[model samples]
Target: METQNYIEYELVDSVSDRNIMTDSREEAIHAFEKGWTVYEHHNTINQHSKFTQSNLTVTMMWNDNPEFQGS
Candidate 1:
């Protein structure tokens, strides 16, 4: 028996509300650097130990919206 773990990253654009999912951390970080919101998903499973877990974390990265600027 062996333990297994899986991880995923989600990038969402604030203005367009579009999103992309990937397993590559580099890609996620690239998107985050470009002002996209990032979310991490982690899943762990161990049949031998009867253990399972899932977690989600959000990293909010946003740029100032020009439309929201005070006149």
Candidate 2:
């Protein structure tokens, strides 16, 4: 399955803790930890932005879901 299943929302301005949504009881936490590590290395904080800011930008293309057209 693709993680592109949902719209990649701009998490920059979001106020809520991402960990909450990511918490599938410790399992999800661990998954995210691994993913976050990759995410950090992949999107190093340049003189530009944070990991979530650069990497979490909305994907204009979705998984063929009409509901995510603007995503």
Candidate 3:
């Protein structure tokens, strides 16, 4: 049996709720630096690995208009 180990990065867009998967660490770091959420996953054949969130952002929205009733 042949075994392989690799790491994958998931770049997420919080606003759009979208995800992009890639094998390039550079690409993941770049996306994270640009405000994209990042997740890291490690994979090994026949073995369980760890999944981690590398970056996160919290967004808040406020409505100052009295006429605005959250519809």
Candidate with maximal TM-score:
3
Displacement of the residue 58 alpha carbon in candidate 2, Å: 14
Deviation from native of the Cα of residue 28 in model 3, angstroms:
0.1
RMSD of each: 13.3, 14.2, 12.8
lDDT of 3: 0.57
51, model 2: CA deviation in Å? 13
Tens-digit per-residue lDDT, 1-71, candidate 1: 96568767667787998878788988877787787866565555211111112322322222223332212
Worst 10 residues of 1 by lDDT: 45-54
Off by over 4 Å in 1: 1-3, 45-71
Candidate 1 Cα deviation (angstroms), residue 36: 0.3
With a 3 Å backbone cut-off (N, CA, C), the pairs that clash in candidate 2 are none
| Shift of residue 55 alpha carbon in model 1, Å | 18
Q: Which digits, one per residue and each the tens of the lDDT, describe model 2 over residues 1-71?
A: 53322211122122342422221224433443445311111112211112333543222223344542222
- Alpha-carbon lDDT of model 2: 0.28
TM-score of every prediction relative to native:
0.57, 0.19, 0.58
Relative to the true structure, candidate 1 reaches a TM of: 0.57
